[model samples]
Target: MKQSLTLSWLLAVAFFAHSQSFNNLPVNTQKPPLHGRHWMAITGKPLAATAGAMIFTKGGNAVDASCAMLAATCTMWDVLSWGGETQALIYNPKTKKVIAINALGVAPTGATPEFFKGKGMKYPPEYGPLAAVTPGTPGGLMVMLAEFGTMSLKEVLAPAMQMAEGYPIEAQTANSIERGKEQIKQWKYSTKVFLPHLGEKREAPNAGEIFVQKDLLETLKKLVEAEQEALKKGKNRKEAIYAAYDRFYKGDIAKEFARGCQEQGGLITEQDLANWKVKIEEPLMTTYKGIEVYKLQQWTQGPAMLQTLNILENFDLKSMGYNSTRYIHTLYQAMNLAFADRDFYYGDPAFPPDEPIKGLLSKEYAKERAKLINPDRNDPNAKPGDPYPFEGKTNPYLTLLEKWGTAHLHKPTSQNPLDENFLEEFAAGTTSVEAADKEGWVVSITPSGGWVPACIAGNTGIGMSQRMQSFVLDEKENPFNVVAPGKRPRVTLTPSMALKDGKPFLSFAKQAGDEQDQLLIQFFLNMVEFNMTVQEACEAPSFKTYQMYSSFGKHEKAVGSLTLNSEMPAWIRKELSRMGYKITYQDRTSGPINAIYFDWENGSFWGGSSNHGEDYGIGW
Candidate 1:
């Protein structure tokens, strides 16, 4: 008889403490210190990072541990999984070089803007042409292990496969599962894994319930066995790794994926799958107060960091006072300038020409742009000023809504105040890892994709990013965010690393769409200028203004007022209001932010996670 999973999965609230013991191990002490050889830090759900730490302790290198973490996260935290893209910035102390792995997938070749228009779709359709993309997490992880790791695929995948086959669903995981249940029911494949038997009458599996993904485990096993066989043939590590990629992208697995896409209205094709290759590009680098900062390129909002940093360079942030009106206004002005440029120029570089980064980051350009800020009064209808000569030549790409003809450039009005009141609720999510050896090599990887309605396919378990929602509708533009062939959608996943005295001082990452770059800038400033500890820097209350989306579009610029976390002083809010700034106080809870800061003088590691998440910063 099939086991009755109902009773086994139902967990009582009183048992929460016990559940946490298994799931929420103390972040700092969960992993025993690694001797002189290696030390690593990971931020995600407590259980998932612990699983990865175990692999590293058992002689696995960074790549081995990262892959293991990815697989386990897929099963344990389906909200963020392997079916999504994994962008990373890895530094090799031996070579003293930084290599970026662009595991982000592309829109399938079969996709076109017209596909969505033909479907009579508008901005946010449940799921159709807009949702299709080449899932890249698996492809990216496999490549990293094959090229840089010391363990085989089988060993790296063992823990995750075993967990998926039989592992208890903790309360946290169960909560996410329950929260996303409605969306999961919308997709056949997602329902099969998350809501297996009950169909429309499905319910969430409770804590202590054994949540299993038999299909995902079997898929992992195939890749593991294939990787081992390749290694047995006396093939070098690199060749064995390539075999793993072939097994997925160009091998039998590709055929299965292609068939699934075809049946589901997904745009992926055999040619798209076979032609896909992860890109290796130099990260956008800049200097802030003699310290070097690096971020992913234009394919993401990575360059916004440079623009913000450039603007802040002109001001003495130290003297502005923390969270003060002057401080917040300056930051907002800098952000607005950066965001304005982002709207006009940021897009897939592979697309037609856009403004080059050099002009955007030019010192003169930032100075010219910074002059536009008026400290006493808010520029209610601020737009991107002509900082660079080319800024004038580039016309704002217009997005057309289905009914609305063309988006009109409207000045700021009471209809859309800079601080329009919306729901002030708290929400958070995760995924970040930091590792460094005594040799000075460091790796920081932040993997992210939205939760629900955007889950990865069965066995693949990759969560497709819903990042395309940020694209605005242009007037007369039939459908907005229409998935086009070779168009890289705007991404929220930005990983950052900072070097102090020619060594890795701080490796930080977080998961908030437009907030990613903004938060990074605040944290970096907190540390470098204000001289705060990692925990203090992150713990400090913050606020953000979302005036525009950083993708190509010409929508009425709506300035959403500053939403300050409650922890911020009331005086700060009053000061902001006095400056003609709209203030919306909100619950300050934020997504998990993980960081590993090296104490060069002490020769030790210090790590911390956002208090809002159930993650611990594990390091030794």
Candidate 2:
């Protein structure tokens, strides 16, 4: 108990110092993330960080540590679980290559935006069984291990499986449970699985309560058994790993999942599970200030960060003063422009190209788009710039809908602010993790889904995602984000890496729904442009704009509006307001922005986890 108090006191002191800064120079009162000569693992939760470190002690690399940490995160139902979505960018120094893993569940082959619209629903429903997609977390993790990890499934899963049976619920996890308690009560399995405390007078477990998820334990045990069986059959390590993946997607677990979905009015069948496969795409790469930045494609909102950087690269940011009114204004306009293009053009690879997205990431195209930003005014309704000249003629979806009259084929717009309530329903709270070994192997992952309104697979205790709600109900107007069978939604769960001169320099992710990349971009700039340490860069004030349609349901937006952290100087806020920015106030706390930095010159590592909630960065 005394030890806990000391840690809390230290963190409180750190956060307070971080909140105040002068002239863009840190006051040095804050506690920066730890630097190490060996391996490091930073996670959304401390237990998961410990699990990853456990793997490192076992001589496992970052790929192995990441897998262990991811599984450990699944032990509790806060932001991630076995039924969640997992997307990652893995860096292999040996090959000098980075790979993208799109391991998210799809609309259950029967899902179409029209189907929901036909049901008299303008926006897709948020809660209940009908909202679920086929879960891919288990399969994704197994697959990642099979390809890059040297640890066995039995080894990596040990920590997660044990914790699934019982663990002291952390404060944030408990709060998340309370947030979804009402939804949990609507489903018997979810109630029994996640909110067992409901059997008592409480709605959910309180922090430090001994919460146990027996079904998850059993499910993980089944996966381990499957891998062991493969070994008994003389299978190699990789093949044993494949056996574990198959067990989750095509074996008994799949059967249980299909049955659960069917009972809940979902359309996924045994076939969908067997047929589902995660695509490994080439990582999206671009050069920023001579350094290479990498991300997932438009399937996520990842490229928007790169696009924002490309636009900002045109100006001398150092002269603007970090977090100054000039800097904030320019950043917001750049983000608004990038997001406008994202709404118009980014979408599933399965869809026919209206125009090459490559052109959207081009420097010349960003120059053209940057011209649209006005110094004296903020555009209430920013429209996508034409990258057609760079890629060719404009595609059909480019001009699909302008004025929403007949083009107003989808949900009617309410005068209400583009409330994130729509995003609240679809996106499960998410978590990001970064792990690295001494050998330079790096892994960054964002695990999502299985939160409130999660569908537990009957008695299996495994949760399933509702990511399908991210799809647009209007088929015609939203050319890129329209719901379709076998198509992944344009999810906001993007994890990223930035390379300095073609070498790994930084890796990071945020969990603020569509605002993920917008927040992280500032962190990137504070480090790259201003040379702030990891913690100082992250703790700096943030500014955001809601001027574009959200990637989530109903596609709501607040055109021309921007929100600045209230902690920013009042003078700067007034200056921004005078510049015609629709201004609002928000908290400036960091966390939900976990990151790690590689200092090649010193041959060391620095890990930083946002002080928000229960996250921690530990290294050796």
Strongest candidate by lDDT: 2
For residues 205-320, write the lDDT of model 1, one tens digit per residue: 77788887777776777787677788899987778878878888887777776766566556677778788888877888888888888888777777888888987898977666
**Stretches of candidate 2 exceeding 4 Å from the true structure:** 1-24, 29-31, 404-428, 589-591
Per residue, candidate 2 scores C-alpha lDDT tens digits across 399-516 of: 4545422322123144533345643532335788899888989999988877655778777787777677677766454567777777777788889998887788998887767778
TM-score, per-candidate, Cα-based: 0.84, 0.92
The CA lDDT of each predicted structure is 0.64, 0.76
lDDT of 2 at 162: 78
Cα RMSD (Å) between model 1 and the true structure?
A: 9.2
